[model samples]
Structure formats: structure tokens, C-alpha cells
Target: MKVTIERTALAKALGHVQSVVERRNTIPILSNVLLQADGGALILTATDLDIEISEEAPADVAGKGATTVSALTLFEIVKRLPDGAQVRLELSSEEGRLQVSSGRSQFALAVLPEDDFPSLSTDDLETRFSMPTSDLRRLLGKARFAMSQEETRYYLNGVYLHAHTDDDAPALRAAATDGHRLARIDAPLPDGASAMPGVIVPRKAIAELGRLLEDAEENVEIAVSSAKIRFGFGAGYLTSKLIDGSFPDYERVIPKGNANVLRVETKDFAQAVDRVSTVSADRTRSVKLALESDRLRLAVNNPEAGSALEELSVDYGGDPLEIGFNARYLLDVAQQIDGETGTFKLADPSSPTVILDEEDERALYVLMPLRV
Candidate 1:
């Protein structure tokens, strides 16, 4: 392949697909990106067996050809080249090398046959839908923090997306949990989304897909089948294999009849949790929250370290209740609440507590109490 492209455009396209290439791979071709140049455009494709990303950029195509080269190395090379310089890439089939030259710098990179690269198919998608990029970003961003890192319960390692109804209106929901804490967010269902099937998007796919949605105004087209999912947007497409496991019944985990209620500023609660956690040890980083008629006190006690206590005025109507929770968990949930006040529904000290953003009714969090 022989193509000439602007340095910045090439780097941006490489940045989109190179990260999906695994550095440590048993197969040499898996670490390389497939480059195809034809008709004044250059297409870059990369994959790690499970997820694949492809991006296209405008180029001056001297010849129509395709080859493979190391993704990270090419990314680094293009990144270091002088800005606005025109870069030329040419493949020497006899030498099995790719020639990269920009201004005074030149380098030869080893090339692999494009036929060796694996291809992910999207033949039979059961459903297809389109939604605003900003809405999709919010759904994934709010629930990703609660996704499980432990692989033992592999089913809990992704966010569950399904069609749901909110306030008698069709809505799309994304939920995730690690047994200890859970997060759920909902967005208004877009046109042609009523028939979308439920799918569990793995943690890796969630992160990569999020990076692709930087432009809020752009629309994302999503296609899903029983075993795979595909996201197509401007100048590119992302394909990922589904987890092939069943997610747990997340609706049952959310508490239903929590009576006690407490309302406090989200910022105040997050900061108080951060302050008290300083005195907590690594193993048991627990903070106790004592709620009374109109006062809330957050305290953390560690025998080896010191103790921290902070008080905040809140609106609490139920009887006094004392609860223990992981300081980190509290902070994670509080940071997601964008409104002025955060509302908490409590059943008791031992039962799971539910938190809701007063201004954002579409999102809710459930945190299990820690035994202090």
C-alpha cells in the first residue's frame, strides 16, 4: 500500500484502534493493525480476538493495496512526527517491510500478511437501534464503576442493557453490580429501539465504546445478536463478542420497602466520606453514619491510626439509625449524583440502603452496609 496522509489525522485514527491490540499475544498478527488504502482513504483495523475496532481517514492514495504493521510502534512513530507534516507509507512486498517517512525522518517497519488477521462477523443481528451519543455515554459512565472485577462470577463482570419502561414510557436501562454495590441508569428509548434484545457488554467493551462517543451530538448505531454486538458511527465500526453468560436477576437485589429516609448535599456527603476514610486502615476501611432527627455524623475509627468525625445538617424524618459502609463505596456512588441533594432510603443498619439523585430520577444506587 502507498498512501500520503496528514500526520495529525493518521495519529488520531491510530489512537482509536491501536489500544485494542494486545501487547502480549501468542499470534504475531494479533499485535498488528491491518492497513488498507484505496480511493483516497486509509482504513486501519485492529483486534484482540474479542473486540475489534476500525477507523478511516482521508489520504492521498498513490496505489491500492493492504498490509499489516505493529500498531503501537506505528502509533508512536506518527505521534513523534512533526505536526502538519505529510506522512508517506509504502509497502515493499519483496522485503516484507513498510516504509514510513515524514520530512527528514524515515523508518522501515516489518509487515505481516493481512490474510492472517482474524475477522469478526455480524451476520444475524436480532435488533438494531440508534441513540444520541450523549445519552449512551451517560448510561454506561454511571454504571461502569460498579461492574465486578472478580472473574469468578463472570456473569457480573459487565453492564446489563435491556429495554425497560419508566413512568409508563419506553426506556433503555444499563445496570451493573459486584454483589456489594449496584448502579443503574436509564435513558429515554429512541426510535426503532423497542425490539432491541438484552445484552451484557463486558467491561472492556464498555470502556472502548465509551471512548468512541466523545462527540455528544453524533448518533451511534447499535446492532446486537445473541452472541455479538456492533457499534457503527462516523467513519468507523466497533464489533465485540458477547460474554456468553447469563447475568443475575439484578432487580431482586434492589431494596423495595426501605422506610427510613435521609437527604443531604451530594458534595457534602462525598467530602465527609473522603475525610473520615483517611483514618481508616486498608483492610477495613469502614465508616459509621449516625443519622438522627436533623443531624448526620460520619465517623471512622482505627486502632492503629486515629479517629475522624464530621457532622452535617441533613433532612431526616424517620427514627435515628446507625449504619456502617465502606468509605470508598460511598464516595463512588456520591460522585455520580450531579444534583444539589442526594436522598437515601434505609431499612435498618444491616439491610441494603438505596440512594437516588433527586434531580436525576433515572439513576439509582444500592449499597450494602458493611459490618463495623
Candidate 2:
């Protein structure tokens, strides 16, 4: 394979795909990127058997061929090369190496047979849908903080994306929970998304895809099957294996009959909990919250460290209630609230409390109270 490409464009395309490739691999070919320069563009493909990333960039094709070269080494080489310098890539079958030349710098990287690289199949997807990159990003940001790190409950380790049709209209919902706190965000279902199947995206896939979504705000194409999911936009495609286990019936966990509702400035409540929690010891930082009329007080008491008491005015109509919640949990939920007011609905101090962005009804959060 031989091609000449602008150094920055090559680096950007290769850099995105190389992130999915691990530094060390049991199969050597998995660390290399498959380059195809036959057509009008240079196609770079990399995978680790579970996730496959492919990106295409415009290039000057000197010859029509394909080969595999170390993805990391190529990325590092392009990164160190002078900006705006053009790069030339040529593969030599006899030498079993790929030559990378840019301006005054030149390097020879070892190559592997492209056939040795594992190919992740996409035949398992059952449904496909499309949404703007901005909407996908909003859903991910709202829910990712609640994803569980514990592997035993593998379903909770990724975001749960499924169809949601409420009284207003059908919608797509993204939800994540770690048993203690849960984040559920719903957006208007795009045309033709009603038939999409529910799936739990794995943690690694979400992490990598989130990085791409940071810069993609126009449109994102999504396809899902039984075992794999693919996201496409522009000239980049990310294919990842979905978690096979069944996600818990999350709807049943959400509380319905909470009568007491209190509204406060989201930032103010977040800051208060953050400041008071600092006085707590490393292990336990439970904050007791007392709500009465329109006044809310947050306090943390520990024998070793003194206690902290902070108060904030809020909107409340029901009788006074005291609840004990993990300070960190409160802070996380508060941060997720998009509006200025933090609306917290409660059944009592012990029952699960629900928080919402009062200005928007589409997103709701449930936080299980922690015993103080």
C-alpha cells in the first residue's frame, strides 16, 4: 500500500481509531491498524475483537494496496512530525515493514499480515436509529455518573437505552444506576425510532464513544443487534459488543407516591453539600438534611471532625421531613440538574427521593437515601 496525505488530517483520523487499540495485545496483529489506500481515500481500521473503529481520510493514492502497521507507533510518528507537512506511506512485502516519511523525519515500522487481525461481525444487530450528536451527548452526560463499576451486575455498568412512550409522546430514554442512585433522561423519540430494541451499552464502548461525541454535534447514526452495536457519523464508525445480560426492570424501582416536594437552587444545594461533606472523614460523609416550610438545613456530624451546618431557602409545601443521604450522592444528583432549581420529591426521610430539573419534565433522578 502507498499513499501521501496531509500530516494533520492523517493524525486526526488515525488518532481516533488508535485509542480503541490497546498498547499490549496477546495477538500482535490486534495492535496494528489495517490501512487500505486503494480507493480515493485512506481507510484506517483497528480493533481488539470486542470493539472496531474505522476512519477514512482524503489522501493521494500512489498505489492501490493494503497492509497493517503498528497503530500506536504511527500515531506517535505523526504527532511528532512538523505541522502541515505531508506524509508518505509505503509498504514493502519483502522487508515486512511500512515506511513513514514526513519532511526531514523518516521511520520504518514493522508490519503484519492484514488477514491476521480479528474481525468483529455486525450481523447480530436487530435495530437501527439516528439522532443528533448533541442529543446523544446530553443523555450520556446526564446518566454516565451513575453507572456502576461493579462487574457482577454487568447490566448496570453501561447505559440502558430503550423506547419510552409516555402520555405526551413516544421518546427514547437513557438510564444508568448503581443501586444507590439512578439517572434517567428521556428525549423526544426521533421519527422511526419506535421500533428500536432496548440494549445496555458496555462501559468501555460508552467511554470511547463519548470522546468522539464531544466534537460531533450534527448527526449520529446508531444500529444495534443482539450482540453488537455500531455508531456512525462523518467518516468514522465505532462497532462494539453489547452486554448480553438482562438489565433489571428499572421502572419498578422508581417511586410514585412521594408527596413532599422541595425546590432549591441546584448550585446552592450542590455547593452546600460539597462544603459540609469536607468536614466528614474519609470513609463516611453522610449528611443529614432537614426540610421545614421553606427552610432547608444540611449538617454533618462526626466525633473526630467537628460538624458543619449550612442552610438554604427553598420551596416546600408539605410537612417537615428529615432525610439522611450520602453527601456525595446529593452532590452528584444536584450537578445533573440542568435548571436553576433543584426539585426534590420525597415520601419520607427513609424512602427513595426523586430529583428533577423543574423546568424540564423529561429527565428525572432517584436517589436512595443513606442511613446517617
Candidate 3:
């Protein structure tokens, strides 16, 4: 294969595809990227058996052909080249090497047969829909923070996406939880998506999708099935295998009858928590919240370290309540609140607390309290 492409365009496409290639692979071809030169563009594809990413970049094709080369190696070479440089790639079948040249620099990388590269098949993707990239980005971004990292509950290691009804209106919901905290965000359901089956998008795929969406076009096409999911941007697409497990019924954990309500300035509450938690234990990182009439006290006491206390005026008229929560978890949930006022619905110190943003009714968060 002989093709010439701009350094900037080649590097961008390589950067997108190489992210899915594992650094170490038992199968030799899995570590390489498949380069297909045809038509007026070069298609670069990389996969790790479970996930595949492919991108097309405009190129000058002198001889149309295909080959495989180390993804990281090629990416590094293209990235280091000076801006506006033209990159030329030629495959020598006799020597089994791919020659890469730019200006006065040249390198020969060992090549693998493109036929050996694995692909995640999307032949069974029965549910296909298109949604605004911004809407999809918000749904995944807001809830992905709560996805579980522990492997014991493998099913919880992804965001659960499904069609649902919010106040009798059809909506698409994304939810994730790690047992201690939960995040649920909803968006208007696109047409023809009501019959889509619920699916758990693995954490790694969620992260990759998030990065890709940053440079994606205004709309993104999505296709889903029982076992896999695909996201198609205007220039390229990503296909990933779905987690083969059932996510828990998360709605049960959300409390609906919490009577205690506390409305505090989001920034003030977050800052006060950050200040008091400075002396908290590293393991627990617990911060205590003592609430009364209209005042809230934040405190952290560690015998080895020191004690810290801060007070903030809040809008609360419920009975006085004291609750302890992980400082880091509190900050994470608070960061998701886009409004100036963050409302907390609490029943007791032992029960879960519901956190909401005053301006966004479509987003909800639940935090499990810790014993102080």
C-alpha cells in the first residue's frame, strides 16, 4: 500500500483508533492497526477483540492496498512530525515491513497481515437511532461518574441505558451506581427508540465514547442489539461488546418519601465540605453535616490528624439532623449540579439522601450516608 496523507489528519485518525488497541496482546495482530488505502481516503482500524474503532482520513493514494503495523509506533511517528509535513506510507511485501517517511526522517516497521485483525461484528444491531451529540454527551457524562469499579459486581461496572417514562412523557434515561452513590439523567427520547432493549455500556467504552464525542459532529448515530452497541460519528464509528449481565433494578434504591429538605448554595456547601474534610482520615474521608433550623455545620475529626469545622447558612426547616458522608463522594455529586442551589432530601442519618439541581429536574443523584 502506498498512500500520502497530511501529518495533522493522519495523527488525528491514528489517535482515535489506537486508543482501543491494548499495549500488550497475546495475539500478534491485535497489537497492530489495519490500514486500508482505497477510494480517495485511508481507513485506519484498531481493535482489542471486544472493541473496535475505525476512522477515515483523506489521502493521496498512489497505489491502493492494505497492511497492518504497530498502532503506537505509527501514532508516535506521525505525532512527532512537524506540522504541515506530508506523511508517506509504503508496504514492501517481500521484506514484510511498512516504510514510513516524512521529510528527512524514515522508519521501517514490521508488518502483520491485515486479514489477521479481528473485528466486532454489527450485523445484529437491530435498533438504530440518531440523537443530537450534545444530548447524548450529557446523558453519559453526567452518570458515568457513578459506575462501579469493583469487579465482583461486574454488571455494575457500566452505565445502564434504556427507554423510560418521566411524568408520563417518553424519555431516555442513563443511570449508574457503585452501591454507595447513584446518578440518573434523562433526555427526550428520540423517535423509534422506544423499543430499544436496556443495555449496560461498559466503563472503558463509555470513556472512549466520551473522548470521541468531543470532536464528533452535531449528530451521532447509534445502533444497539442484545450483545453489542455501535456509535457512528460523521467521519468514523466505534463498535463495542455489551456486558453480558443484568443490571440491578436501580429505581428501588431511590427514596421517594424523604421529608427533610435542605437547600444550600452549591458552591458554599462544596467549599465548606472541602475545608472541613482537610483533616479527615484518608481511608474514610468522612465529613459530618449537622443541620438545624437554618444553619449547617460541617465537621471532620481525626485523632491522628486534626479537627476541622465550618458553618454555612442553608434553607432548612425540618427537624435537626446529623449525617456523615464521604467528602470525595459529596464533591463529585456536587460538581454535577449545574444550578446555584443544590437541594438535598433526607429522611434520617441512616437513610439515603437524594440530591437535586434546582434548575435541572431531569438529573437526580442519591448518596448513601456513612456512620460517623
Candidate 4:
């Protein structure tokens, strides 16, 4: 393969796909990126068995062919080349090396046969739909932080995406939880997505997809099946294998009868929690909330460390109640609240608390109390 491409364009495309290639691989070909040069463009693809990413970049093709080379090495070479310089890639079959040159710099990388590269099939993706990129971003971004990192509950390690009806209007929802906290976000459902099956998008794929969305344009095309999911941007696409497990019925955990309500400024609450938690014990990082009338007291006490206390005026008329929570968890949920005021509905110190964003009613969060 002989192809000439602009350095910036080549680097951008490589940055998208090379992330899927594992740094270390038992199969040598899996560590390399497959480069196919043809039709006035260069297609770069990389995979790590479970996920595959491919992108096309405009190029000047002198001779059309394909080969595989170390993804990391090629990316590094292209990144260091002089700005605005054109990069040329040529494969020497006799020497089994790929020649890379830019201006005055030249390097030769060992090549693998393109036939050895594995491909993730998307033929079975029966459900197809399109949504605005911003809507898709909000659906995944708001709930991803709650995804479980523990492997024991394999199904909880990713976000649960499915179709739902919110107040008789079709909506798409994303939910994630790690048993301690849960986040549920809703967006208007796109056309022809009502029959789409609920799927658990693995954590690794979510991270990669988030990065790709940063460069994506106005709309994103999505395709789903029982076993896999695909996201197609303008010039690139990502295909990932779905978690082969069932997510728990998350709605059961959400409390619907919480009576005590406390409305506090999101910024003040988060900052107060951060201040008090400074002296909290490292193991628990617990912060106690004592609410009465319109006054809220935040406190943290640690025998080895010191104690911290802060007070904030809130909008509350419920009877006096005290609750304990992990300071870190509180801060995480606070970051998701986009509005100035966050409404907290509480039943008791032992029950889950529901937090809502005053500006965006479509977003909701639930936090479990700690035994402080």
C-alpha cells in the first residue's frame, strides 16, 4: 500500500481507532491497525476482540493496497511529524516492513498480513435509529458515572439503555447503578426506536464512545441487536459487543413515597459537603445532615482527624430529620445537577433519597444513606 495523507487528518483518524487496540496482545495482529488504501481515501481499523473502531480519511493514493502495522508506533510517528507536512506510507512485501516518511524524517515498521486482522460483524443489527448528537450525549453522559465497576455483578458494569414511555410520551432512558447510587436520564425517543431491545453497553465501550462523540457532528446513527451495538458518526463508526447478561429491574430501587423535601442551592450543598468531608474518616468519608425547618447542618467527625461543621439555609418544612451519606457520593451527584437548586425528597435516615434538577425535570438521581 502506498498512500499520502495530511498529517493532522491521519493523526485524528488514528487517534479514533488506535484506542481500541490493546497495548499488549497475545495475538500479534490484534496489536496492529489494519490500513486499507483505496478510492481516494485511507481506511484505518483497530480492534481488541470485543470492540472495533474504523475511520476514513481523505488521502492521495499512489498505489492501492492494504497492510497491518503497530497502531501505537504509527500514531506516535504521525503525531511527531512537522505540522502541515504530508505523510507517506508504503508497504514493502519483500522486506515485510511498512515505510513511513514525512519531510526529512523516515521510519520503517514491521508489518503483519491484513488477512490476520479480526472484524466485528454488524449484520445482525436489526434496530436502527437516529438522534441529535447532543441528546445522545446527554443520555449517556448524565448516567455513566453511576455504572458499577465491580465485576461480581457483571450486568451492572455498564449503562442500561432502552425505550420507555414518560407520561404517555415515548422517551429513551439511560440508567446505571453501583448498588449505592443510581442515575436515570430521559430523552425524546427517535423515530422507529420503540421496538429496540434494552441493552447494557459495556463500560469500556462507553468510554471510547464518549471520546468519539467529542468530534462528532450534529447527528449520530445508532444500530442495535441482541448481542451488539453500533454508533456511526460522519466519517467513523464504533461497533461493540453487548454484555451477555440481564440488568436488574432498576425502577424497584427508586423510592416513590418520600415525604420530606429539602431544596438547597446545588453549589452551596456541594461545597459544604466538600468542606466538612475534609476531616472525615478515610474509610467512610461520611457526612451527616441534620435538617430542621429551614436550616441544614452538615458535620463530619473523625477521632484521628478533626471535625468540621457547616450550615446552610434551605427550603424545608418537614419535621426535623437526620441523614448520613458518603461525602464523595454526594459530590458526584451534585455535579450532575445542572440547575441552581436541587430538590431532595427524603423518607427517613435509613431510606434512599431522591434528588431532582429544578431546571431539567428529565434527570433524576437516587442516593443510599450511610450509617454514620
Candidate 5:
């Protein structure tokens, strides 16, 4: 295959496709990206058996052909070329390699047969929804951090997406938990989605999708099936295998009916916890929060080291209560709070407490208490 594509344009497309390509592969062809030149455009495809990404860019084509070249090698060559330069890629059948040329630099990459490359099947999708890139990015960022890495409970390794029927209407719900803390966000459902199936989107897919959606405000089309899910942006298409295991019924873990409420400034609470937890050892980073009347004090005790106590004023009318929580979990939830002040609903010192966004009733967070 012979094609001439701009350096900047080719680099952008390669950056997207190469991320899906595995660094090491037992099969030789899996390390290369399949390049097809036809109809004034160049199509690049890369996959790792479970997930696949395809991107297209405008290019000048002299001959209609297809070939496969190492994705990493090709990307490195494009990235090093002169800015705004045109890159020419040609197939050398006699030498059994592909030649890449841009201005003064050149490389002959090993070529593989296009027939050996595997392609993802395009099955019919049941539910389709269109969402802005900004909204999708926000939803993923709010919940993805809480996803678990443990493999014993395979379902908790991804974010659970479904529609909630709380009242007379349906709302879109996205949640992630690792048994320590949970994050859940609710958004207004789109017009086409009245009913949606619960699906567990794997961690890798969520990470890749976030990278693709960065700095893009255009609309993205999403479709789902029993086995797979697909995302189609204007420039590329992404498909991945859904987790086969069923996610647990997460509603029961979310605490409710906690009357003891305390509203404190998010920035203030986060700073206090960060300061108090410094003396604690690495393995034990627990901080105790003592609430009394209108004053909130954060204290951390370490037998080998020292103890720290800091105070912050909060608005609370309930009785004085003391609770201990992991310093790391408190900072993560506080960082995600969009509003200035956050309300923490507590029933007792041992039970899991609920946290709500004072400005937004839709977003909810539950952090499990710890024994200090």
C-alpha cells in the first residue's frame, strides 16, 4: 500500500490506535496495525483480542492496497518527523517491508499480511444513545476512581451503568464501589432511553474511552448489546467486550435514613485531614473526626510516631459523635465535590455514613467507617 498523509494528522490517528495495541504479543501480527488505503483516506485498525479501535484520516493515495506494520515503530517515526510535514508510506513487496519517508527521515518497517489481522464482528445493538463528550467525561471521572482492582469479585472491577426508576420517571445512574467507598451519579436520561439494561463496563475500556473523549465537545453515539458495547465518535469507532459476570445488586449497600447531618466546607475538611494524617504510619492512615456542637476536630494517633489534632467549624445541630475513616477515602470524596460545602449524614460511629452534595441532590457518596 502507498499513501501520503500529513504528519500531524497521521500522528493523531496513530496516537489513538496504538494505545489499544499490546506492547508484547505471542502472535506476531497482533503487534502491528493494519493500514488500508482507499477512496482518498487511510484507515488504521488495532486490537488486543478483547478490545479494538479503528480510526480514519484523509490521505493522498496513489495505489489501492493494504498492509500491516508495527504500530510502535510507525508512531515513533511520525512523531519525530518535522512539524506540518507530509509523510509518504509505500509497500516494498520485494524487500518484504514497508518504507516510511518524511522530508529527510526514512524507515523500512516489517510488513505482515492483512488477511492475518482479526476484525471485530459488527453485531446489531439494542440500545442507542447520544451524549455530549463533556457530560460523558464528567460521569466517568466522578465514578471511575472508586472501581476495584481485585479479581476475586470480578463484577466490582468495572463501573455499573443502568437506569433507575425511583419515581414515575427513569434516570440514568452510574456507580462504582470497592467495598471501602462508593460513588454514584445520576443524570437525566436521554429521550431514546426509557429502559436500559445494567452493564458492567470494564476498567480498561473506561480508561481508553476517557482518553478519546478528552478535549472533544462533539456528540458521541453509544450502542450496547449483551456481549459488547460500541462508541462511535465522528473520527473513530471503539468496540469492547462486556464483562460476562453479573454485577451485584448495589442498592442495598448504599446507606439511607441517616438523620444525624453535618455540613462542612469541602476544601476545609480536605485540608484538615491531609494535615492531621501526616504523622500516621503508611499502613495505618486513619483519622478520627470528633464532632461536638458546632466544632469539628480531626485527630490522628500513631503509637510509634506522634498524634495530630486539628479543628474546623461546621454547621451541625445533632448530638456530638465521633467517627474514624481512612484519610485516603475522605480526600477522594472531597476532591469530587463540586459544591463548596458537603453534608455528611451519620447514624452512628460504626455504621456506613452517607454523603450528599448540598447543591446537587443527584450525586451521592457513601464511605465505610474504619476502626482507629
Candidate 6:
């Protein structure tokens, strides 16, 4: 395969596809990227047998052929080339080498047979819909932080994406939890998504999708099936295998009828929690929140280090309550609140509490309390 591409354009495409290739692979071809040159563009595909990413970029094609080369090696060569340089890639079938040249720099890389590269099957998707990229990015950002990292409970290792009805209106919801904290966010359901099935998008795919949508402003097309999910935008597409296990009924975990309520500025609440947490060790960092009529005090105690206490004025009129929570969890939830004020609904020290943005009803957090 022979193709001429601009350094900047090729580097950007390689950056996206190479992330899917693992650094170490038992199968030789899995660490390489498949390059196909056609009429006017070059297609790059990389996969780890689970998640696959394919991207295309405009290139000057001198020969229509396909080959595979080490993704890391090729990317490094292109990245080091001078800016605005035109890069030429040619495959030497007799020598079994891929030659990359830009200006006076040149490198010969080993090539693998393209026939050995595995391609994921494209089955008929059960549901296909399109939504603004901004909306999708926001949905994932709100809930991804709570996704579980443990592999044993594979069902909880991803964000649960589904369609639902909230307040008599159709909505698209994203939720995640790690047994200690939960996050739920909703957006207006896009057209043609009523029949979409709930799917657990794996953590790796969620992270990749987030990177893809970083500067996107257009709409993103999504296709979902029982076994897989695909996200398409611009000249790139990503396909991922969904978790086969069933997610727990998360709605049942949300607390109801929490009589105690407290409202405070989000910035103030987050800063206090951050300051008090420094007194405790990293592994067992817990902060105690003491609430009274209109005051809230944050305190942390560590036998090895020291103790810290800070007070903040709040809006609370219910009975006094004291609760212990992980300081990191509190900061994460507070940072996500879009409004200036953060609202907390509490029942008791042992029960889970609900937190919400004073202005946004579609987003909330559920946190499990720890024993102080």
C-alpha cells in the first residue's frame, strides 16, 4: 500500500486508532494497525478483540492496497516528522517492510499480513438514534465518576444507558454506582430512541468515547444491539462489546421521605470538605459532618496525624444530624452540581442520603454513609 498524507492529519488519525491497540499482545497482529488505501482516503483500524476503532483521513493514494504495521512504531515516526511535512508510506512486498519517509528522515518497519487482522461483525442494530454531541458528553460526564472499578461485579463496571419516562416526559438517562455512591443524569430523549434497550457501556469504551467527543459540536449517531454498541461521528467510528450481565434495579436504592434538609453554596461546601480531609490518612480519609439548625461543621480525626474542624453557615431547619462520609466522594458529587447551591436530603446517620442541584432537577447523587 502506498499513500501520501499530511503530517498533522495522519498524526491525529493515528492518535485515535492506536489507543485501541494494546501495548503487549499474545497475538502479533493485535498490536498492529490495519491500513487500507482506496480512491481518495486511507482507512485505519485497530482492535483488541473487544473494542474496535476505525478512522479515515484524506490522503493522496498512489497504489490501492492494504497492509498492517506496528501502531506504536508508525505513530511515533509520524509524530516526530516536521510540521507541515508530507509523509509518504510505501510497502515493499519483496522485502516485507513498510517504508516511512518525510524529508530526510526514513524508517523501515516490519509488516504483518492484512488477512490476519480480525474484523468485528456488523449486525443489524436494534435501535439507532442521533443526539447532539454536547448532550451526550454531559450525560457521560455526570455519571462516569461513580462507575465501579472492580472486575468481579462486571455488571457494575460501566455506565447504565437507557431510555425512560420522567415526569411524564421521555428522557435519556445515564446512571452509575460503586455500591458507595451513585449518580443519575437525564436528558431529553432523541428521536427514534423509544425502543432502545438498556445497555451497560464498559468503562474503557466510555473513556474512549469521552475523548472522541471532546471538541465535537455536531450530532453523534448511535447504534445499539443486545451484544454490542456503536458510536459514529465525522469520519471515525467506535464499536464496543456490551456487558452481558444484568444491572441491579438501581431505583430501589434511592432513598425517599428524607425529612432533614440542608442547602449550602457548592463552592463553600467543597472547600470545607477538602480542607478537613487533609488531616486524615489517604486510605482511611473520612470526614464527619455535624449539622444543626442553621450551621454545618466539618471535622476529621486521625490518630496518627491530627484533627481538623471547619464551620460553615447553611440553610437547614430540621433536627440536628451528624453523618460520616468519604471526603473524596463528597467532593466529586459537589463538583458536578451545576448550580451555585447544593441541596442535601437526609434521613439519619445510618441511612443513605440524597443530594441534588438547587437548580437542576434532572441530576442527583445518592451517597452511603460511613460509621464515624
Q: Write candidate 4's Cα lDDT for 267-368 as tens digits.
A: 999999999999999889999999999999999889899888999999999989999999999999999999999999999999999999999999999999
Task: Please list the residue runs of candidate 6 whose C-alpha ends up more than 4 Å from where it truly belongs after superposition.
Answer: none
Return whichever of 3 and 6 wins on TM-score.
3
Q: What residue pairs clash in candidate 2, if any at all?
A: 124-225, 125-224, 125-225, 126-224, 126-225
Model 4 clashing residue pairs (backbone): none
Off by over 4 Å in 1: 165-167, 215-217
Report the lDDT tens digits of candidate 2 across residue range 312-354. 8888888988899888878888877778987888998779988
**Every model's TM-score:** 0.98, 0.95, 0.98, 0.98, 0.95, 0.97
Q: What would the per-residue lDDT of candidate 1 be over residues 1-372, giving only the tens digit for each residue?
A: 899999998998899899898889989999999999999899999999999999899999999999999999999999999889999999998888999999999999999899998999888987988998888899999999999999998888899988886459678999999999999899999887777778899999998988877732388888988789898877898899988888888889899999999999989889889988999988868999999999999999898998999999999989899999999999999989989999999998999999999999999999999988
Model 4: lDDT of residue 6: 99
Off by over 4 Å in 5: none
Off by over 4 Å in 4: none
Which of candidates 1 and 2 reaches a greater TM-score? 1
Question: How many residue pairs clash per model?
Answer: 0, 5, 0, 0, 0, 0
Worst lDDT window (10 residues) for model 5? 188-197
Q: What's the true lDDT of residue 192 in model 2? A: 72
lDDT of 4 at 218: 93
Clashing pairs in 5: none
The lowest-lDDT stretch of 10 consecutive residues in candidate 1 is: 209-218
lDDT of 2 at 107: 87
Deviation from native of the Cα of residue 43 in model 6, angstroms: 1.1
Which scores better on TM-score, 5 or 6? 6
lDDT of each: 0.91, 0.87, 0.94, 0.94, 0.87, 0.92
Tens-digit lDDT track of model 5 for 70-148: 9999998888888899999999889998999988788888899999999878666788888777667767788888899
Question: TM-score: which is higher, 1 or 4?
Answer: 4
